[model samples]
Target: MTVTLQLEQLSIMPGQRIVLRDVSWQQFEAILTELGDHRASRLAYDNGMLEIRMPLPEHERSKVLLSDFVKNLLEALDIDFEPFGSSTFKRIDMAKGIEPDECFYIQNHAAMIGKRRLDLTIDPPPDLAIEVDLTSKTQLEVYRVLGVPELWRYESGRLRIDVLQSGRYVESPISPTFPDLLLVERFPGFVEMAATAGTRPALKAFRQWVKEQLQL
Candidate 1:
């Protein structure tokens, strides 16, 4: 059976993918707390090998806002990625799959071809999957399950970069996700740069920084 992911009684997307909706906040809290307290890690339910990612509360806002930031950046770079897909599916998927506030494909637009469920034929998990964490769940379990090569989790205004290696994830100071973007010496300030400069300005600044390093 398929489920739709929705917000406030409106369908956000359509597909056979599982989605979480219609559950009361109390019930949602109960489930999240149990998973976090007992598992001490992130958990996603799947009867088959299909991947899933779920987000915690408060993170929803964080991820959405970050999406706006990233979307603007991608546009400035002339990169192409659809902001959203299959709204009707999101409105009703009961399986409770997590949605990345923003998602994009690096290569061809043809990769989006599929029905009901997401087409995973592409490699490296769509270049990046950004998350906003408000709980104890680690990216280790989440990224592994998602089979994504790179993941960026934002927490408390800081970004933690994770790179998938040998079927597991590793935390590193540098990000393998956007190898072109360098964060030398001032890695921590990357988000601040994005925040303060705005998307286009921040991206231009990032490019300038990269050029400076190349010249040096």
Candidate 2:
């Protein structure tokens, strides 16, 4: 006897994830359609492996704060960017897909402006992708296969910068996008500040800090 479970029947608790193996790309697409776009959970699919995760409150808070910091940095530097927050990016040819906590098109912002749909074969991947590693580890392989230039992973209250170099991610001390700014050194503190001092106040303080750095 065999039993089949509907995607809706499956319940993933906050800060937990469920992994399914041997899922075909077609099946992945169906699952995504079934899951729809109005949920809090995140999904990652690499070839035949699929992971569905439900984020905790802390995870959501961190994701928003970090995304805000990135926006602030770009604005302070007077760089134009298009933010695609948690939008599912997938390539059928590559057989890989991921929804980042926050993603931005910085260098290729102009190309992506006013785009409603993304065709990875013709369209470039996001220049920067941010992942908050609280419930599940980031599937770097999927990001690499998609050819993302820069990946920011926040784990254990610290941010790790990884740049795609010759088809593999190499850890770097400084962000390629903001080499002059010490984000790895400064961002974690501000994330913590948001928890205690409130989101608006922390963001205001961070903006001030950015101004100070720029003046120096």
Candidate 3:
């Protein structure tokens, strides 16, 4: 006798992830459909590997706060952007798919505005993506295969910036998006401040800091 379990039957606790091996593209699509849009767990698929993760409350808090910082930075600079929070981006040809914690279209904002759906074959990947790596490590290879230009990963109270170069990611001390601002140094402090001083106050202070930087 043999028994098989459905995806729905599996319960993924917060801050935990389960990897499924030898998963095909068609099966991945079916799993996405079964999971639907209103779910909390995030998924990443690369070649024949699939990883599903459930974010803890701490993970979510950091994601939201840091995402807010991105928005505030873009706004202060008066730059146009489109925030696509945790949207699934995939390409069948590459056999890769990933859902970012938060993503933004800055340079490519004009092209993505008002778009209801994404087709990676024709449309360009997001200009920047944010990943809160408190729960499970982010799959950098998946993002690279999908051709995301920039990625920001936050872990252990520090932020790491990576820029795609020659089809690979290189750790950079400065962000290509905000060359004038020192986000790698400043963002972590603000995120920590948010944890103790509260979101709104921390954001308010961050906005002031950005304004001060502009004056310098």
Candidate 4:
């Protein structure tokens, strides 16, 4: 349940990624707490593999843009959702742990409605996870182990909607929650537009666009 490697720093794209080898579950928990209130570093642990990477300013920028867009879209559609941004999710039985860049409980919103702490043993996983992948590639295996149903991955200035099927993620042409929207052809460009527009303007523009689409 661990990768035994030295805490070596490898120079990558934006920030430093420190990889630790042979870490115990207790140590991981301690480190997470030690990291208390630090928002810029991201942590990933699967089995015994532990990776911590400091996030760049631009990374946070793109993440917020995409996050706001999804939240705004949900509101416009009048869909009840609970946003969980960068919340740690771990299952001891599965030996996997991860925190999505942003996640939402939609289809199962009612199940988790008004709740705070999420224990996978009792609470269902988020129906959709939003991942901003420009900084690094997300570990799909983590999501698979957690049994998330859908993923929205944004990378290299593009957006993709994926749905999990039979223990694997496949590129989906449209979103399950927002089924009427055609993602492959129209949504990617729209994503860029909204991200560029900033949150307030983006919400205004998105609500207008959604109304036009629904003819409301």
Candidate 5:
């Protein structure tokens, strides 16, 4: 039997997160759609376990900056991609559900081009997903089940890229989207600049930096 929190009866504290065990996929979907377009909290479900969290202000800051960094890099490198910010992805048979902070289709962009709707069973999963984890760790295992190809995790002003290999994710020193952009050697400083310079100036600086790097 599936059960959910009786919000009308329960008292939840400010910034309190709620998790439910034995939640069916349908219940999770209903809850996700009910809370449509709300960015105050993030939710994830794996099999029958569901987790909800209210992100901190710093979380949003890092998320925006990190997403800006990727979009800027893609534009500078002229890569084709589609952004799916916080879209819910679930597969009943796979017993997995996720709402990524931000996701994108790059290498498989053409495959998904002009599609009216995305069905993970018939469609490919997003190539990359970004998580600015300030409150808790991401469920990479859930992503692994969903067949996500790559992940970028930022925590405490640092960034790390992980690429799916076989059935496991292996941390990589180079970005899967831009292989030439050395993640360990060159990307860390850029992350710092974004977090410190504020969004607009950091984006401007990043555009300039990418142009310079391309010229070299």
Candidate 6:
């Protein structure tokens, strides 16, 4: 059985160190088994420390903005990646859980067919995971446990990336996962503009940027 206790006193601080406690990997797996697709997050205990995870709330604009940017970039470059569904990440099972803002798939969209529950063990990990952090927390640590290849965290309107290297996460400015793509410095600020531009304007801008990047 899993139990959760909230430590509201620990107000999340920006760039502050987060400590996870009282978690076990086995316990986390059990919780995942129970919740199935309904599960949002899970906790893992490694050595002595605990890790908690929950799903970040749904932000339609952010998802569309980011997804569209990636989709258009890939299409313009003739790279193949079709996004089928996006899910908000959540961690359950341990003493603490964190839910990232959004998660998505690049390939293997066929595996997701007719499925309501996500079996991480069966479902291949996403090609990319995106998190928009309004507050600081240990959400990224889930990537370590899940072995996701690439992670993108957006904060303060800037994007920071983490890619798995030699079985561990390393932050980098360049995206090894999609090396041909170029995201301009002003790209982060594009999200705010997306809100005002509506779908057509945003798509136009994204298409323009993609074409420019591809010299098409």
- Model 1 CA deviation exceeding 4 Å by range: 1-43, 46-58, 84-97, 113-125, 134-142, 183-216
> What's the best-to-worst order under TM-score?
3, 2, 5, 4, 6, 1
The candidate, 1 or 6, that scores higher on TM-score is: 6
Pairs that collide, model 3: none
lDDT per residue for candidate 6 within 1-216, as digits (tens), equals 976754444444333344455546565555445546554343334444654444344344465567777766667766655353444233333233333445556555456655666556566666777665534334556566666788887766787788888888898777775665545364675676676767667778777766676664
Ten-residue segment with the worst summed lDDT in candidate 6?
88-97
TM-score-superior candidate, 2 or 4: 2
Which residue pairs in candidate 4 collide? 1-48, 2-48, 3-22, 4-22, 5-21
> Which ten contiguous residues of candidate 4 have the minimum total lDDT?
3-12
Q: Write the per-residue lDDT of candidate 2 for residues 88-138, one digit (tens) a residue.
A: 999988789999988999999999999999889999999999989834444
What are the models' TM-scores? 0.51, 0.96, 0.96, 0.86, 0.87, 0.62
| Per-residue lDDT of candidate 3, residues 94-213 (tens digit) | 999999999999999999989999999988999999998834444788888888999999999889999999999899999999999899999989988888989999999999999999
TM-score of predicted model 1?
0.51
Q: On residues 103-202, what C-alpha lDDT tens digit does candidate 5 reach at each position?
A: 8889998887776666889888899999876344336778888899998888755677889999888999888678876655655677676667766776
Question: How far does residue 68 in candidate 5 sit from its true spot (Å)?
Answer: 1.0
Q: Against the correct fold, how does model 2 do in TM-score?
A: 0.96
Question: All predictions: root-mean-square deviation over Cα?
Answer: 10.5, 1.4, 1.5, 3.6, 2.7, 6.1
Output the lDDT of residue 87, model 4: 87
Residue-level lDDT of model 1, residues 144-194, one tens digit each, is 665656667676667777777898878767765345555423443655665
Q: Tell me the whole-model lDDT of each prediction, alpha carbons only.
A: 0.48, 0.90, 0.91, 0.76, 0.77, 0.57
Q: Can you give the lDDT of residue 45 in candidate 2?
A: 90
